[model samples]
Target: MSLNVLAVDDSRTMRDMLNLALSSAGFTAHLAEDGLHGLEVLSEIEPDVIITDINMPRMDGFGFIEALRSDDRWSRIPILVLTTESADELKAKARSAGATGWIVKPFDPAKLVKALQMVAG
Candidate 1:
């Protein structure tokens, strides 16, 4: 089955790039502008994996993960955090909030595909 993925970021460019990259890597991708929008999109599309940015308007990545984890239906969904923040503290926070893994920003498409494969597999 084709993997369904949700790419959540405040930047339109980032969302578009992720969508293109994931689609090229054989996954169907859905784009969301921010955490709040991501939640709304998730309600409509049951994605196999979620890739999100840390900083966003309305709601951030942490809020997104917390919300997801609180929901029984979405708690076990694999989450791959894609962010520019490389601080260990932030990584720990993400882990505590239930992110499955993380990928630093400016990540290569191939590396992202590998990470996604590892998480979604």
Candidate 2:
């Protein structure tokens, strides 16, 4: 079966880029403008993997993870945080919030595909 991926970011450009990349990698991509929208999308489409940015307008990545973890239905979904925040503290926080993995911004597309493969599988 093809993998289904949900990409959540406030930036339209980022969402588009992720959509393109994941599609090229042979996965179906679903885009969300922010964390709230991501959650809404999740409720409808049970994606195999989720990738999100940290800084968003309504409900940031941390809050999104908290909400995901709080719900038993969504708690097992793998989440890979892809953000510009390179701070160690932020990485730790993401880990604490239930992120399956992390990818820093300006990431290589090949590496991103590899990461997605690792998480989504």
Candidate 3:
């Protein structure tokens, strides 16, 4: 099955890279600039998996995850944190916020695809 993925990041280059990686893996990718933009896009599509960055304007990843977890429509979806931050405390915080997994930045495309399949397929 082709997984519908939502990638929320403030970087245009990161968004472009994710789009390429997902497309190459035969998955549908939806791009969002930040947490707020992600929420807006969430209204339009039901994603199988979500990949988000930690730092952003308007709303951060933690806030985004919390918001999603609070909504019945999105609570069960898997959320993966893709960020440059590698602090253990931050990971714990993200976990508490309802993240399903964590992946450090400069991600491997193959691994990301595998993770998405494992979690969403």
Candidate 4:
């Protein structure tokens, strides 16, 4: 089965890139501008996996991860943090917040697809 993904980023360009990449790989892509928008989209779609940026306007990735993890219904969804930040502390924080995996920004589309499959499966 094809995977459904929710990609949350404040940059329209980034969202567009993700859409192109995931869609090209036979995955259904859903876009969200930020954490708040992500939550709204989340309510409508049951994504197999979620990809989020670390910094965002309404809610950052950490806050977003924590918020979703707090809900029993969404807690089990796999979340992957895709960001420019590569700080080990930040990775640790994301891990504690419930992210299933991490991908450094300027992500390779193929690798991102593989990571999504790994996490979702």
Worst 10 contiguous positions by lDDT, candidate 4:
1-10
lDDT of each: 0.93, 0.90, 0.97, 0.95
Estimate the TM-score of every prediction: 0.97, 0.96, 0.98, 0.98
lDDT of 2 by residue, 1-93 (tens): 368999999998888788888888888999999899999998889888899999999799999998999999889989999999989999999
Report the lDDT of model 3 for residue 6: 99
Relative to the unseen true structure, what is the Cα RMSD of model 4?
0.6
Candidate 2: segments with Cα more than 4 A from true spot? none
Among these predictions, the greatest lDDT belongs to: 3
Candidate 4 per-residue C-alpha lDDT over 11-113 given as tens digits, one digit per residue, 9 for 90 to 100: 9999999999999999999999999999999999999999999999989999999999999979999999999999999999999999999999899999999
Better of 2 and 3 by lDDT: 3
Candidate 4 yields a Cα-based lDDT of 0.95
User: Lowest summed lDDT over 10 consecutive residues: which window, candidate 3?
Assistant: 112-121
Span of 10 residues, lowest total lDDT, candidate 2: 112-121
Q: Root-mean-square deviation of each candidate, in angstroms?
A: 0.9, 1.0, 0.5, 0.6
* Runs off by more than 4 Å, candidate 4: none
lDDT (C-alpha) at residue 67 in model 1: 97
Per-residue lDDT of 74 in model 4: 94
